[model samples]
Target: MSWITQKLPDVLFIQEGPGIRKYEYEENGYPMINVRCVQDGYIDMSSARCASMELATTKWKHFQVDEGDILYTISGTIGRSAIVKEADLPLLMNTSVVRFKSLTPDLDPKFVYYYFKTDLFIDELLGHSTGTAIKNVGPSHLKKMDISYPSLEEQKRIVAILDQAFTHIDKARALTEQNLRNVRELFESYLQQVFSLIGDRYVEEALDDACELITCGVAATPKYVDESEGVPFLSAQNVKSGKVVLDKYRHISKDLHAKLTKKNMPKKGDILYSRVGAGFGEAAVVEHEFEFSVYVSLTLIQPIEAKLDSYYLKYLLNSPQIKSLARSSITSSGVPNLNVKSVRKFLITYPALQKQKSVVRSIELMESEIGNLESIYQNKLLELDTLKKSLLQKAFSGELTKNMGEAAA
Candidate 1:
């Protein structure tokens, strides 16, 4: 059978929600589905806000989402879609989340949902979308969009094949994601075990006593320059949990670097700790003798080599216990900022220098193993996503039906 093409409005009824004001929102009433509630193929109503029953029934009655209705995000992150189930009934669509219902029996809602997942549809939608920062598409844009499908029977067959294929793909993707999580948790568990059990040989002291100097970096923003004319600058973002990342780092003029380094230079064996914003509590030891100046968001820790191992201190700072402590110490007034005084007061528990090195070696070895597993699982996830996209492309191109017929023969 050949495919028939029609405008989306001729086959489906498309409508977005009423613009609800903050005052219209309430503690209990009809659940309002927003763009955030719409995942790729399912609705996450957990974060859905509530609108008053009066508003839902009176002003927004026409916007009520029905069972089997497909919800597509029209603004911000465009083209993400989800099919509304029976359990999701009685929910009202909020702005930016448009609902689609089949206007003709020839169109299977599930088939249309799968088509939305296709790159062809998404690319067209994106092309028509407007906005530099947050892209948006109106119902009029969707109304003019083309939708192609075969007979009703063939549509159901395509949906069935896609359902089975995507089920397996999604299962594999879920397992891969869980494996990635497990690999990360393994490293965290090891860190927990190492730090939680303090032995008789362990000596507990404040970081102030164990470190030769603990100071933050320059408060003033440095004048940036070309790499050849300046030195690498470090910030909270440059410091990862266990290592420094310079791939996206900026360069500051030599004069500015020299001026900043006079008070807060990070040399070899020093620890760079992210002390503010999203990266707070993360620490990485400086293993190179290369010159760099840090931002105020980073703290420089020069550990007394005789008393504490630099790697040990770094691992400790990144440990679950210390991270929890650091979170508790964060200033409540502004952006999540960890005060330098909190770093000075941090309790450091350690054994002899040799034992500290031994612990570091063990953790590093385990980390290497976990890193390999993480890479494998991550790659598997990427592969699964590619497979899914390939299946969608084939399904929409009519090749999937042809392949299925050959298989049946």
Candidate 2:
């Protein structure tokens, strides 16, 4: 606390959002930046709304956004901030954001923006924010926040060092993201090739012929009485492509589960296929022993023990070909949906049981390799992010400038 008082003593001018209405925006007028515009140290003006220049000036003159001013988000998603650029000029702040202009000329706006991105600043802001459902921190709270103050030249040097470091870091991240995409596309392409390669010995059979049971999940959903106190309930969101996501799961009472289970109780080896909504056609085999109920949007498939392998069927259902077919089979409706009958009609080109095992083995190897690589990439990304935060901390603590001077000498 003494460190903050000693370092930061200048006045800070903070302005809340204009709280403009939808009717105030115009097709051909001045730009209006919202919380979405401020991200990753830059203001993206492409999606900003245009408002009547005359009306904005008359009503929201105080909220006028200028180049070099810091655009900060104060509500909904707090702590995200960006420095306003020349391209983002001639704009106004919406209700969800606030503008901060440093009254102290010694402080660099970019330095202040970078400081706001630090963990200390964010934690402080979050601590002061008040709300039960949605947290919010007003200008009064922001004004009380403290920050390190250095010489103007020292601040600029630190900013330059950070700017250079981040440029390289961002470039590496972009390449990693592209590589991840390429790896996924390669896997999908190989998947299609594997399925397409069928010999004369292979036979075409309806999906229903290979499955002992194909049925929809529970029709009635239990209300969210208490999230932590009930049995796990699976939905379309919980069922991913080739995987079952258990996080963010809803719950139902024991009585409701008993009632819902009357339709069907999910068991180990049962394939949970998404029949409606996003991720339609994706499937995952339930490999756990825990009891859980699923929503109606997911179709439960129990493959014949002798006729089909559950793991093989899971990969097949998640393939691009089957996903496309499922989308095409949907009845002309407002939302995409696949019924049990249509799903049953999907053709399955199956090989002998032994050959099926060989194919599954091959695909599993590729999936495992991809999963490992993804884990490495994700860890590296996290490391890079951590390094960035560490650099920010050092820059504000005066160690960054001190180290740079020693290296130069």
Task: List residue ranges in candidate 2 displaced over 4 A.
Answer: 1-10, 20-31, 45-55, 132-134, 205-209, 219-221, 225-229, 275-280, 326-345, 402-409
- RMSD over all Cα atoms, model 2: 3.7
lDDT per residue as tens, model 2, 1-409: 1123332325456787776677877998778888788787778877788877887788777778888888888877898888877866777878778887878777788888888888888998899999977889888787777877667887788888888777777887888888878878888888888888846788688999988889887777658547667888888888865888887778888788888777677899999998887568888989899988888889999888887888888888877788788988987487678888999999988778788888999999999898888888888788778878888887777678646533422
Would you estimate the TM-scores of all the predictions? 0.85, 0.86
Best by TM-score: 2
lDDT of 1 by residue, 168-284 (tens): 778888888988888888888899899887578988999999998999988888778998888998899988757888777889998888887786677988999999898799999
Model 1 off-target regions past 4 Å?
Answer: 196-199, 215-235, 247-262, 275-279, 287-297, 330-337, 402-409
- The root-mean-square deviation over C-alpha atoms between each candidate and the true structure, in angstroms, is 3.6, 3.7
Instruction: Output the lDDT of residue 91, model 1.
Output: 89
